[model samples]
Target: MRGMTDLGPLSLSPVMKPADPPGEPLPGIIKTKVFKEEDYINMPWKNGLGGTKQIAIHPHTADFETEEFIWRLALSEVRDSCSFSVFPGYDIALLLLPEDERDGSASVKNTVHLRRGSLTSPVALHHNDQATAVPLRPLTPYTYSGEWPTSCKIRTGPMRHLTFIANRELTRVTATLETICLHGLHDDGECSDSDEAVHKAPGEVNGTKKDATGNGNGTALPLGDECKNPMNGNVNKLLIGNYSIVYVVSGAVRVTIEGTLEPHTVLAGQTLVCERDDDSSPTDLAMTPLRKDGRAFEKESEHQDATVLIIQVNILRPERRRHSSLSDVSSFSQARPRGRSGSIIVYDDQPLPPLAGIDGDTAASSAARAVAGPSSPTSTIPMRSWDSARHYKPPVFSSRFKNESEVPPAVVRDQLIIDEFPVGAISTVWINMVKQGLSEWLRIPVIVARGKEEGPVVGITAVVHGNELNGVPCIHRVISDIDVSTLKGTVVAVPCINVPGYLRYTREFSDGKDLNRMFPGSPTGTASQIYAYNIMEKVVGHFNYLIDLHTASFGRVNSYYVRSDMNDAASAAMAKLQQPQVILHNSGQDGALRSAAMTRNIKAITVEIGNPQQLQNQYVQWSYQGVMRILSWLNMFQLDPADLAPAAGPPSSTILCSKGYWIYTKTGGVLEVYPSVNTVVRKGDLIARIKNIFGNIVDEVYAPGSGVTIGRSSNPVAMAGDRVLHMGVIKREGEVLAREAKENY
Candidate 1:
């Protein structure tokens, strides 16, 4: 039997290791090697329609024609319709290269017909019966399985494409290709032949002349005074897993590695390959544009920039183990030989009770059960303690509270007894769950601050939608400012509720479930549900009041506002305490934390800060102040009257609306918003305009009712039905009618 090594945790596997020392490979590491363009093997395709340039192959010894390779990358040109090679167990990905510049929009009428089982079979992949064209865009890749006798026919003239193939049973491979045109680098606005234009010396356009000082034609601007490649300052380190290849598409670049003395010049149509031990430190490489003649320059020079396509490959193995600090244990069955008597047992070299019939099962069956348990050869098993039960210490309250004997006891006195926290102290607790494979634990941090005096327990949760990061700092500030000993009651803060999404920099769980929608979650449900259940049961149910912090979704900006069920006096009062510029009378959405708390008779409101993903300091500070104000209003904390700033006159009466709608664009184009968030508008007011690529206005979006803009799209590109603005119609004070009558056309 083959013994497998276990990698401790999945959370740490994706992190790149630090750079290794020069010239030494780490132990147990798989080595990587780079393959250059000139080194690629030139051979005829299996179908012989055109030749193929084999980029790299796994197991180095595998030949394209004779031996079975685990994976391969290659390029081929198609001049005529042709059959493709059949690989019984391989998955294939194909990318169409840019159309030949010489072709230049002559209505080439290109179509690629694909058949799965045989060349004579009907099309297996097509848009419709009338359209057989494979939408092959430049640098855009299409992936398909090559397990059967698959082939494709190209109707247009000669076209070149790239292909990637990997054995479905052995390895997984992914490829991405993008081309960045450097036409903007030429200030003279002159075009040249494809190859010559790409290789032109920096600072010198084809039709332009240069003087002794190395400046281009007087009319053309010098390529920035220093001539430095903008990419030189970037960190371009690559971790060599198994094998990796970088191909220059249409530009020249200088490559510098740690151990190399001088940077190597790589030109268009060339490749720079590097092979290193997988477990070794990362290989840091700096790439910049190469000067003419590949000469080294101390200062910036006139050099054209190039676009490069990088492809990374990793060889998969069954017993792969990652470095970790956790301890690994061996189960009893794994330690004993096959057919061993189950009646015999040992613990720390001491004999224990026999395994024969403790549970009324036969010894042979018991042995089989042990082998079928949750333990695997490649799993990191945890060792059990000699003592079967755990002992927990009791928490002691602050001595200062002993003198106040007249004070009434808390309604939930036993709550603190089970909790591992001392009264009048701030501490953190981890809510842990067994991961799916029982290979690791998923831990969520919960910060708790208990007060010596009894008052209302408040809960603050942020990052419910992981990308809404602005509220994270607000919670941090609230926690830091509240002195546990002086605070009344208690404050619980969960700075990042969606741990998985926060780690991945996304807005949802790994399973694609929205965490916010899994409130009052079920224990037997999905991952998000389990997490939500634990939080609501352990933290939310104990709160007397709750503030759920959030921000706009990605690519959108929002003004500071509060959303609460204004019909409920308690919820309405909590919303008003935030002192936001806009207060929306919204009944929290079902499954939302705020809604769940409201049902529990807890006053709750959601604070909508600025943008998502990024922490805007101004908005963060604003949210922090808002939270502090709420605390002061509840009498949970006190501040000197003299220190309070003067209130900004009478607040614009809170905008009351039954609901709001996000206005979407009817057409797709480059959108230009005419108003910012919080701007008031009348019916028919122009809110945005869409322009075609040619700078012609295509359409204009106007407000359908008198309302205030609470949110608007920040991304310039828009597709049909993409939300462009979020408007809240004013329903109180007759403001809508007055504005409409005043702005009558």
Candidate 2:
């Protein structure tokens, strides 16, 4: 392969293959083509959005409008905030580069705020939540699903970027910008290691930025002017896939494949494409930076800077198999009753899972059976996993509550964990959750409303899942509106409990662990566990009753609903007072904050407000009213005159359900959930549909049983194992469990 200096299209040699391959290129000498600046195709973007500079495609003449290529690359220009074009079924990777030589101030203002699918969809939110931004360090490659509605806001002047899109079904692509100092002293004094590269160049170093020189993974060798000619050691090794591309981001580099006898010199703006055999182990290469004279950079020489973008691609790699896009269940053989709200619909499809039903940790296959079994069941119709659940005994709270380990609730001495029940005061304070990295602390904002008269402490927490924000305003309003002078009890509101997740605007904690599932966490465990333990010990322990406020996670929508154990008189009372459209008699999901609170003899219930990442004022008002009603019932406060009336509309059709489960997608595609929140449907009714990028419907979801929709997936983009619809079964009016629960509780 020749490295060309002239900007002209070179004629093909007789043995050269087509630039675009039909499928996987046939086994032979690797073929590649370079597009000169003059040959690059520049045109208006899709929908006349903006301008695009393009080169390199699988189908040399593939149409981006039709999304017909296996992969495509483009360079885009941006200045301020910008929205990215949505491309279905393709995985997108981007690299940020400077518009020109930059200064120190630009570094601070150049970072970009990136978001995918508006709220990171169901999978990203569940699996990889983070709030950190991608800095404008030139050459750092960041990737996301192409179909997601992605956008970025730049803090500074004009910037240019490289956008790479690869077909999810046919290939894998990854790019890393590395700073290589082939010959520089590892120590402060003299020559040391041969390869001292900042492997994670122009980007994050363990999710943090160290300096402007790009020493992400390791230290960049110090280079001085005094040292001159030096000896070359064994070169740094770079692993490659079917195609290994070396694009010189800055300075120059001397590159040579292991088998090649001669080395080639590549200049800045030039990209070297190397191809090897299919399914072969990554190719090892000798790569070294070059001096201005084109010779290898010497140890301690003035050749202090060199950066390269190494992009690897594999052909014909099949995409991962997704959960079934649709699942079917036979008719409900029996409808059993567990409580006033519990309408247990026993279907033939879902099997019994483990007896220990965890609220937040259930996987796709066992999702339906994860709901907490009733404290006492009237259901003659056996539910899934009931055989095992019948053998398990519930935790009995004594005078002093204890966890499963029997660790007594130890009153903590820390300033925030311990409370001073001051009379007639409303106070707001920030409590540290955890220390991030070296110095940053993620803190929770707590609002405490203490009444003049001593009474039970009620804890209200919101945003346990970062994106679930509807409850945030609801908590704030209740705490602010309450009259502490006349109130009989204390009210504590944790507006944003999962601070890292809230800041990141995703569903999970900073470490990507679902904080809701790590309750009563250990003092020594994973990050999420430690944080969870702290909340239980420091914040939650202060309350005698807990109202864990919530909303839908990313890519999902929910109706106002309450999940509470009807067996508990106080919890059930709180649930009914919320005025939710639906009440599911879920004792509590294990590991859920509400459930964890219950173990401490703290009456608890979970209140789901609405869709996430938004302040739906209507839902917020409803939630505020619900909390106020609960407070009034507890004799904590007198209700406002205006709140005496029910919600704005005709009283909502509040349905009571015994059990619920989320249906999952079988495959990946664009999805449309047909059922709206609170919609009632029968076994054969259409619930949702999925379509391939070409617009042909690939899958259709039918209702598994007659039920009211509790919540469902909202994002149009779908992947296997993502949510479909939350189905809540309806019980006959005046069921046997309803009469028995009131008497027993």
Task: Give candidate 2 misplaced runs (Cα > 4 Å).
Answer: 1-413, 417-421, 645-651, 733-745
Q: What is candidate 1's TM-score against the reference?
A: 0.42
Which 10 consecutive residues of model 1 have the lowest summed lDDT? 6-15
Q: Whole-model Cα lDDT per candidate?
A: 0.57, 0.60
Give per-model TM-scores. Answer: 0.42, 0.44
Clashing pairs in 1: 20-281, 32-275, 33-275, 34-273, 202-302, 202-303, 251-306
**Residue 338's C-alpha lDDT in candidate 1?**
16
As a whole number from 0 to 100, the lDDT of residue 126 in candidate 1 is 34
**Per-residue lDDT over 482-575 for candidate 1, one digit per residue giving the tens place of the 0 to 100 score:** 6555677777887888888898888887678888778888989987898788777766888889999999887788877887887778777878
Off by over 4 Å in 1: 1-419, 433-438, 640-658, 734-745
Question: Clashes in model 2: which pairs?
Answer: 131-504, 323-666, 324-665, 324-666, 325-666, 342-658, 343-658
Best-fitting candidate, measured by lDDT? 2
Model 2 lDDT, full chain set: 0.60
lDDT of 1 at 156: 51
Evaluated with TM-score, which candidate comes out highest? 2
